[model samples]
Target: MEAFTLSSDFGYVVLVVVATVFLLQWLGIQVVMARKKYEVSYPRMYSDNDDRFNCVQRAHQNTLEVYPTYLILQIFGGLYAPKLGALCGLIWLAGRVAYALGYYTGDPEKRNRGAFGYIGLLTLLVCTVMFGLSLLGFI
Candidate 1:
């Protein structure tokens, strides 16, 4: 077996990580814009009077909630298969965009449009497990 060391192949995973950061930033900007449009003063996490602003805020907040897990899974899993991890990360990112767009419509149920992201998450979990097994010579 080859000794593990960072390689250029991981570039794809790095790109995906960068893309996800941009996505989170873009989503945050959307929330900020929504706050301005709805006048939901700072320090206030949500709008009591405007469901639209709340929807936008929720979209971004929800993404933040899952961000850590996604990063951990992607990075660790990419150690085993960077290309596959990046592809899954891209799929997850696309799903997040759909989710935010759907949530922006002020209809919570529509957020399910991003359900496809589960495929990426599931695969990442599998990859991570595989990496662990490989490390332990159990594969």
Candidate 2:
């Protein structure tokens, strides 16, 4: 068995950075939502305040829903081709960011567009799984 080394190709590093950014953004949204949920603010029409909080909450949930699968695929696929995994990761991250931003604005159309991010993330996971299975002679 080979020991897992942290060093990866430049592309993996890029993927890691993108993932970290998305994770941080997700966490930030959670924090904002938590604060707003606890504290009341001035009345407003569009700001409804709660809407944004709800949006963030949903975004957090979405991130949580996808991150585990992304991580697993990234790790396994990275072992085979860090560069490719990183590229896929970048696409996923971009999609998530766009989705989060569109969702925050409460635009259904925009939110739908963001779904592409999840698709990209899933693609990466599939590639990773395929690589792992191939390496293990399971496929």
Candidate 3:
């Protein structure tokens, strides 16, 4: 078999992945800052005395809960349509930012502002399915 090499076409997806790492780090910092602000100890995941801190923690935790799936979809989906997948990844990233900002406001209901992120996830899901179909020779 010939040696496989990553083509420049996948550059955008690589950039998106890098950006995602920074974003997650920022979110983690936010959680740490929130913990300090609320005086929540390290062992404690949430603050019983401060719902705001809980909101911040939940925002990070929720994103983490779905992160593995996002990465999988992004990488596999990018294989089929790199630019489009990268665009969708950007959208998802933006949504997570909005979601965290809303949650930071101490109003749980405001987290809906990031609901648009699902569109990106859904599109990536479609791309992944298409990639699978193509591999199966059904496309």
In terms of TM-score, which candidate is strongest? 1
Comparing 2 and 3 on lDDT, the stronger one = 3
Models, CA RMSD each:
1.4, 5.1, 1.7
Sequence-dependent TM-score of model 2: 0.69
lDDT of 1 by residue, 4-32 (tens): 78868899999999999899999999988
| Full ranking by lDDT | 1, 3, 2
Runs in model 1 deviating more than 4 A are none
**C-alpha lDDT score of every prediction, in listed order:** 0.94, 0.66, 0.92
Q: Estimate the TM-score of every prediction.
A: 0.96, 0.69, 0.95
Residue 93 local lDDT, model 1:
96
Q: Model 3, 1-139: lDDT tens per residue?
A: 4454565778999999899999899999999998888999989998779899999999999999999999999998898889999999999999999999999999999999998988888999999999899777799
Residue 139 lDDT in candidate 2:
88
Which pairs clash (backbone N, Cα, C closer than 3 Å) in model 1?
Answer: none
Number of colliding residue pairs in each model: 0, 0, 0
- Per lDDT, the best of the predicted structures is 1
